[model samples]
Each structure stands twice: as C-alpha cells, then as structure tokens.
Target: MKFSKTLINWYSINKRDLPWRKTTNPYYIWLSEIILQQTQVKQGLPYYDAFTAKYPTVFDLANANESAVLKLWQGLGYYSRARNLHATAKHIAFDLGGKFPNTYKDLLKLKGVGDYTASAIASICFNEVTAVVDGNVYRVLSRYFGISTAINSTPGAKEFKQLAQKLIDTKQPAEFNQAIMEFGATQCKPKNPDCDTCPFNSSCIALSKNTISELPVKIKAAKAKKKHFNFLVFISEDEKTIIEQRQGKGIWQNLYQFPLIETEKATNFKSFKSLIKDHELLTNQDFELLLYNKEAVVHKLSHQHLYTHFWIIKVDKLPINGINIENVRDFPVPILIGDFIERFNF
Candidate 1:
C-alpha cells in the first residue's frame, strides 16, 4: 500500500476522539491549533473547551475584553498566542465580517497564523488542498524517510514540507491532513513509539536502517536567559493590592503583574532594601514589610527563566493605582503572578 493510504487506514481505526476533530468550524480549529502550538493535546483541550464555552463565536471573542481573555488563558503559557488569538478574532469578526479566510494563502495574513496553522485551517475547514508541517510531522517524516537534515533548519523544513505536500490526498484533503497529523502524534511519537505493530514498520526507513532513535536530528535550542524578579505584593489597610499592565513588547505583554524589580542578581532582604532605597522607590516611613514568600516562584518561559520572589508590603494607604482584591481577577495576569495570588495570604 502507498504511504497515504496505509496511514489513513491505520488512522480510521485508531484516531482519538478529540473534540476539535468532530467539526469543520474554522474558529474552533484555529483556537485548538493556537492553544496546541507549544502545549500538548491533553493540556490544550480543557483550554479549548473553556474558550469556546466562554466565547461561542468569533464575534463573542472579539467583543470580549482582552483582560478577560488573558485571565482565562492564565496557566497556558505562551501568552503571546492568547493576545494574537484575540487580535485575529477581532479582525475576523469586525474587519472581515466574522468570516475566516477560506484559503491557506489568505489565512496566513491573520496575526499569529503561520504556514502550518493556515494549512491546517484551510484544508480542514474549507478543504483547500494544502499540507501542514509541524513538529509532529517533522518527526514522522524525518524518521520514516531516514532524513538526517536538522528539522529546525530552513533547508530541512522546505524539503520535508515539499514531501508532505506531494503526499497529500487531494480528494479528501481534510481527512488526509488530520490522519497524517494524528498518526504522527500517536504512532510516530517523539519517543518509544510502538513500532512492532506500526503499519509502516516494514517500510519505515529508520526501523529498517536501525536508526530510529537518531533519524529526526534537531539542533539544540539556545540557552534560556536567567533573570531575577522581586515582586512587591503591595497591600493597603483595606487589603487592596497593586498591579500594572505589562507594556511594550516584553514577555507578558498586555498582561497584569505586580510592581516588579528585576535585578542583576537574586535579592535578599538587604538587597531588597538597597534596591528600594537606591532606586528611591517608596517613602521610608509609609510602607512596612510584612513577609516574603517562603518560596520563590521559579517560572520557566520558552527563552527565559524567571526566579521570582513575592514580597508582601503593607501600606498606610492604597497606591492611587491599586485595585480592590475583589476586582483583581478581572485583569489579565501572567500565570506566574496568578499562582502567587492563589497561594498568598490576603
């Protein structure tokens, strides 16, 4: 049997009953794809259901507050995807009359929609004959073909994408696309796939050549930058706390966080005092230190590792900018801050 037919036959019997696979709805497909970008299906599914339940349509998502969207997206890291998803929803709802672009080429124009995403949306929703190439696809192809090219490199991407495009079953583009991706995700997994019963086991290049473990070569990613964060969890006599929206193009852009003091080194009580006084942060007598979090929140982002310590501060009066504890959840905040909020004593 040919590659596409063999894969499709296996998929028909083995495909997991995922929520997103049950529909041709572009919005749901787009949402699932975005949420699953840096996350696994298990982690992204609940988020997918939550978003769809909260915002049933593109117009609903577009009309909803950005803060609300981010809050719902709290723990699913890669906050930029949430922001972009909101932006694209608005574009589709308002600018494009709530219609998702039907072609892969047009879908690529929306914010955060990349080639693979556009292809998946286009082919799956509109039956456009396009191929999708993601990490799973990369793994499956490189191993089956015994290709040695680094999957992250440009030449490798082009080569694999072309091969995938050639093999797409144009008659049932959606089914074909989903089958291959599902096959890759389940059968040709990153590690220890059950090759003994795999349909392609006999013809799989990596298995035949005894190089399954080493076929899908990938270069090591650049080291993540480490930074120290001391967050002032300021509370007033009324129990109100302080938070500010992250501005500019930083990691948690548009998300709310505490008054942050990023330092060249991890800070202790003495170091905190020096940082505050030297920076002329607060009036000496107005604020008092109540306590510090017994443990620091060590949050790992894609390219940055943040060692964060939350310092509890008691102030005579609320900062003109602070919000009531009751209203703090309304604002969008990074998951790191959300975790701190969930654990801190009011």
Candidate 2:
C-alpha cells in the first residue's frame, strides 16, 4: 500500500503531460500504445498526432487504405505493427461494430494487442485492475526489488508480472500503472538514474545495494544478420521509373521499392552489373548501368543490417507498368529507400 501510494504521489508531481494520459478513450489509448511500442515518446508523438487526426475514430482507420496507413507510418519502422493495426481496426469496426474490448483477455484477441497493450488499454480506459508489465515496469520493479533474474527469460517475465499485479493499487489501477512506468522512464532510467531525488531511493533495494545499474538484467541478443541489396533504379527518357511492391512476409512487406537483386554478400560494380544484366526486367533492353553510390548504405534493423547499393539504369523506354518518376514520393518505402529517393535528386 505504501509503495503504491508513494508512486502515485510522485506521479502526480512528475508525470509528463502527454496527450494520451489525458484521455480515457480506448481507441486513443490503444493507438498511443501501439505507436509507443519499441519507440521513444519523442519519436512516437508526431506519429500519434498524425494517426489520431487522420483517423479520428476506429471506423475511419478501418476505412483507410493500407497504403495510406503505411505512408503515415513511414520512418517509424516496425512496419508489421502498422499492418496489424490496420487489420485489427477493420475487424473492430466491421465485425465488432466499433466497440473495443473492455477487458484484458478480450483485448488480447486483437491482432496487434499483446499482453502489455491489452493490460494498458484495459486499465487506463476501462478502469480494470490489471497491471501493465512493459519495459519500464520491468525496470522499475527489478531495480526496486533488486531482482537479478534476466528480464527476457520466461520465468523472469512470470515473476515480475506476478509481483507487479500484487503491487497494483486496486482503487487506482490506472494511476498506479502510469506512475510506476513514468518513474522508471524519467527517474530510474536505464543509464545514470537520478537516484538522489527518486521517491524510492531510501528503500529501493538496488539503490541501497549499489546495484541499480545491474538489477534489471537482460540477455544479450544475437548479432544482427548482414544482407546485401542492389536496387535497380530505372530511369527512362519519358520521365518514367520502375518500382515494385514487396510481396510475402519479411522486412518492408507491401512497401514499394526499385527492382532489387539481393546477393549473398557485397559485390563489386563489375560483378553487380553482370547480375543486373541477366535480370528479367532488363531482358533485351539497351541500357547503361551506372553505380549511384560507390559506398554501401548501411541500414540497420533490429535483426538485420542491410548494405544497400542503388544502381541507376538509364533506358530508352521503361516497362509498361512503370510509374512517373515524380510520383515515387507518393509510395510508402522503407526509410533506406526513402532516404535514397530524397537524396537522388531524380
């Protein structure tokens, strides 16, 4: 009771004035949560504003085209979240008649709503006494209790979740959940936490034991896999260019990009040009291939690092399905390709 009260008290004075915190609407809360996942508040705020303004309601989001949603979500990364969000919005609007689930269990049924998101929406919107265990919650709890269990481990997850549930304030689950998470984010941060001013500094186990830096342990992730991508940028005399929509499940699925030829490893210009010469898109076409970038553009994702090269192919005529070069900006592409387009100057 004291722990919960202390956190809520601190929260009242220290919590950020975020837009989502001001609303109890499940749609708004759910949208904020999805955008904030694996994203910093500073980086995610603009996207949240854009999404809410554009959609305004669940029905609007459901009615929006996937391309538009992806376009709005561009540069935010984690594109699958955008796709799942679109799918879930449609399901809610059409199938459920625009009513978001009120309980954690029911919310879990949504395509992108996992345990953390479900719990957040359930508690914040519906006043359900469900505890939300996200990265911030894990950090706050582990450091306060001096728990050394690896947070990524299954047992660690179960233990921390159980502890958080037991510590939640039944009378004010929303405030308690937000308080603890806020405390972790602003005070008990991952690096150089402000221990002297923290509400729990006197009694926090990690603070007393000088283990604040080591309390919330996480297992190291595997090395990012390296991939080589050679994008063929076709430019025709008639101001047309070729862009292909990525299909199947993988990075940047459903996004548009130039014709690509991936290699097992980075290749020299001569070897890469030879590979492009045999490409089906260039079959029997008289073209001049020029390497746009001598150095590979390294784009890093969570699990993969992409070494990309843009090959500019000047052609007399483009394929029948090619689009005008000026309109390429309208298509949603990965930030890697998007950056290239912005810098390539047509």
Candidate 3:
C-alpha cells in the first residue's frame, strides 16, 4: 500500500477525537489552526473552546474590541496570532462582506494566514488539495524520506513542501493532511517516537537505523538578548495604582503595564532616586520608598529574556503625566505581567 493510504487507514482507527475534527466550519477550523501553531494540542483545546464559545462566528470576533480579544488571549501568549486572527476576521466581515474565504488561495490572502494554516483550513473545511507542512509534518517527512536539509532553512522548507504536495492523497485530501499531522503528533513524535507500534515502522528509515532522534536536522538558534526592567508600582492611599498601556510595534504591544524604567545594569536605590529626581518625577517632595523587594522575575521570550524587578511605592498622588487609575483585571496585560500582579497582589 502507498504511504498516504496506510497513514489514512491508521488515522481512521487511531486518531484522537478532537473538538475541531467534528466541525467543517472554516472559522472554527481557522481558530484551531491558529491556536495550535505554537501550543500543544492538550493546552490549545481549552483555549479553542473558550474563543469559539465566546465568539461563535467571524462576525462576533470582528465586532469585538481589541482589548477584549487580547484579554481573552491573555494567558495563551504569542499575541500576534490573536491580533492577526482579529484582523483577518474584520477583513472577512467588512471587506469580504462577512463571507469567510472558502478556498486555500483566498484564505492565504488573509492576514497571518501562512501556507500551512491556509492549507489546513482549505483541506479540512473545503476538501481542497492543499498541503500543510508544519513542524510535525516536517519531522515525519524528514525521517521517512531520509532528507537531510535543515528544517528551518529556505531550501529545506521548499523541499519538504514539494514532497508534502506530491504525497498528498487528492481523493481524501482532508484525511491525508490530518493523518500525516496526527501520525507525527502521536506515533512519530519529536522525541521518543513509538516506532514499534507505528504502522509505517516496518519501512520507516529512522526506525530501521536508530536515526529517529537525528533525522529532522535543525540549525542552531540565535542566543536570546537579556534585558532588565524595573517596574515602579505606585499605589495611592485609596489603593488605586498607576499603570500605562504599551503602544506601537514590538513585544508587549498594546498591553497594559505599570510605569517602568529599563536599565542595562541592575538599578540601585541611590541611582533610582537620582534618576527619578532628574526626571522631576514627583512634584513637590521626594516620594518615600516604603519597601524594596530583591526578588527579580525572569520572563523568557523566543528571542529575549526579560529580567523584571517590582518596586512597590506608596505615593500621596499619582503621576499626572504617565499614570492612569484603572482596574488591573479589566485591562489587557501580558501573561508574564499578569502573573507578576498575581504574585505581588499590588
């Protein structure tokens, strides 16, 4: 039997009954695909259900506020996905006149709808013959075909995409796509793959040679830049605190955070006092620092490590320029900052 047929046969009997698999609605399919991009299936399912339940259709998502969308996606991280999802929904609702794109080519034109995502939505929802080549599929094909190209490089992506397209079973496009991905997810996993039980184990190159762990070659990742941030949490007598929402492009875009001072070196009390005084931060008198906490939390991003310090300050009045008195729970904040608030409670 051919690889595609064998894989589909295996999938029919062994695939997990996921919530996304039950529906052919492109909106929900797109939601699942986007949520599952950087997240594991187990972690992503609840988020998928939450989003779909809250915003049932593209119109619902498109009509929602950016803050509300970000708030719902608070803990999920990789916020660009949420932002793009919203943008795409709006495009569909307004420009496309509330009609979700049904074809792979049309879906690809939407914001953040890359080849893999477009293909997944197209095949699963419309039965289009589009190939989806994600990390799992990359691993499966690299090992099966004994391809040595670095998976992240341009040449590697092109080669794998071509293989995926050629190997796709046109008659059962949806099943073919799902099976290859599911096979990679369950049996041909990144680490400790269960080759003995896999239907393709008999002919799988990596299994035959003990190269399963090494087949999916990846180039070394660049080192993450380390940056330090000292957050000043100014609390009024009424317990309201000063906060500001980050604006413009870059990390933590449009997320609410407390007043912060970033420094290359760890900030000391004397330097902080001098710096604030230089900036004329306080109006009349020097604000007294009640207590200084030594604990520094390290939040890791894909390309950076954020070393954050929380300084609690009690002030007679809030800063007139940079601070806003708002409920922290009501605003959209990054998950790391949210965790910081929960841990400190101020």
Candidate 4:
C-alpha cells in the first residue's frame, strides 16, 4: 500500500504531459503503445501526432493503403510493427465491428499486441488491474528490491511480473501501473539517477547496497552478422529508374529498393563488371557502370551489419518497367536507400 501510494504521488506531481495520457480511448491508447515500442517518447511524438491526424480512427487506418502506412512509417525502422498495426486495424474494423478488445486477454489476440501492450490498454482504457512490465517497470522493480536476476532471462521475467502484480493497487490499478512506469522512466532512470531525492531511496535495497548500476542486469545479445549488398542503380537517358518491392519474408518486406545483386564479399570493378555483364537487364545493352561511393557504406541493423555499394548503371534506354525518376520519392524505402536518394542528385 505504501509503495503504491508513494509511486502514485510521485507520478501525479512529475509525469510528463503526454497526449496519450489525456485519453482513455482504446484506439488512441493502442496506437500510442504500438508506436512507443522500441521508440523513445521524444522521437515518436511527431509520428504519433501524424498518425492520429491522418487516420483519426481505426476505420481510417483500416482503409489506408499499406504503401501509405509504410511511407508514413519510414525511418521508424522495425517495419513489421507498421504492417501488423495495419493488419490489426483491418481485423478490428472489418471483422470486429470496429471494436477494440476491452480485456487484456482478448487484447492479446490483436496482431502486435503483446503482454505489456495489452496490459497497458486494459488498465488505462478499461481500468483493469493488469500490471505492465516494460523495460521501465523492470528497471524500477529490480533496483527497488535489489533483484540480481538477469532481466532478459525467463525466470527473471516471471519473478518480476509476479512482484509487480502483487504490488498493484486493486482500487487504482490504472494509476498504479502508470505511476510505476512513469517513476521508472523519469525518476529511476537507467543512468545516474538522483537517488538522494527519490521517495523510495531510503527503502530501496539497491541504493542501500550501492548496486544501482548493476541491479537490473540483462544478458548480452549475440554479435550482429555481417552482410554485403550491391544495389544496381539503373539510370536511363530519359530519367527513368527501376525500384522493386521486397517480396516474401525478411527485412524490409513490401518496401521498395533499387534492383539488388548481393555478393559474398566486396567485388572489385573488374569482377563487378563481369557480374553485371551476365545480368539479364544489362545483356546486349550499351551501358557504363560507375561505383557511386568509392568506399562501402555500412548500414547497421539490430542483428546485421550491411556493407553496401551502389553501382550506377547509365544506359540510353531503361526497361519498360522503369518509373520516372521524379516519382521515386513517392515509394517507401529503407532509410539506407532513402538517405542515398536524398544525397545523390538524380
């Protein structure tokens, strides 16, 4: 009771005035939760605003084209979230009569709605007593109780969830959940927290034990894999180029990119020309190839590092499937390609 009350009190006084906090609408709440996943508040605010302004309702989102959604979601990375968000909106709007599930269990049935997201929607929108154990909650709980378990471990996740559920205020579950998460994000930050003024500083086990930096430990992830990508940028005399959609499962699915010719290792100009000579698009065509960047551009993702080289192919006429160069910006592309488009003059 004391712990919950202290957190609630701290939250009431110190919580940031975020737009999502002002609404209990399930559509808005769910949107905010999905956008905030793997994204910081500062970075996601504009996107949230853009989404709300553009879509306005679940039906609007459902009716939108996937390309538009992906385009709006450009530079936000982890594109699967946008795709799932769109699919779920269609399911809710068309299949569920535009109704959002009111319970955490049912909310989980929605695409992309995980335990933390479902709990957030259920508590904030429906006032259910479900606790959310996001990164912030884990940090706060581990430090306060001096738990040394690795947060990413299965046992640690279960133990922390149980502790959080046990501490939730039944009568004020919404406030308690929000308060704890807010407390963790603002007060018990990951680095150099101002423990001297914290409400729980005296009772915090990690503070007393001086293990604040190490309390909420996480297992290190495996090293990222390396990949080499060679993008063939086709430029014709008529200012036309070709961009193909990434089909099937993998990174950047459904996004557009220049026609690709991947290789095991970096290729020298002599070897690259031989490879291009064999390409069906370049065969029997009078053309010249120029390497766009002398040095490979390294694009890093969560689990893979792509060493990319763009090879510019200049020809008198492009294939019939080519698009006007001016319209390239209309297509949704990965940030790597997007950055290149912005930097390279057509």
Each candidate: what lDDT?
0.86, 0.92, 0.85, 0.93
Flag the better candidate by TM-score, 2 or 4: 2
Which of the two candidates, 3 or 4, achieves a greater TM-score against the reference?
A: 4
Off by over 4 Å in 1: 278-281
Q: What is the lDDT of residue 276 in candidate 3?
A: 67
Write the candidate numbers in order of decreasing TM-score.
2, 4, 1, 3
Candidate 3 regions exceeding 4 Å error are 290-292, 321-326
lDDT of 2 by residue, 1-346 (tens): 3999999999999989999988899999999999999888999999999999999999999999999999999999989999999999999999999988899999999898998999999999999999999999999999999999999999998999999999999999999999998898898899999998887888889888998878799999999999999999999999899998999989899999998889999899888777777677777788998999899999999899999999999989865679989999999999999999999989
Residue range 38-103, candidate 4, lDDT tens digits: 788998999999999999999999999999999999999889999999999999999999988899
- TM-score (C-alpha) between model 3 and the true structure: 0.95
**Order of quality (lDDT):** 4, 2, 1, 3
Who is ahead in lDDT, 1 or 4? Answer: 4
Winning model by lDDT? 4
Better of 1 and 2 by lDDT: 2
Instruction: Give TM-scores for every candidate, taking all chains together and pairing residue i with residue i.
Output: 0.96, 0.98, 0.95, 0.98
Cα error, residue 122 of model 4, in Å, equals 0.2
Compare the candidates by TM-score and give the number of the best one.
2
**Candidate 3 global CA lDDT score:** 0.85
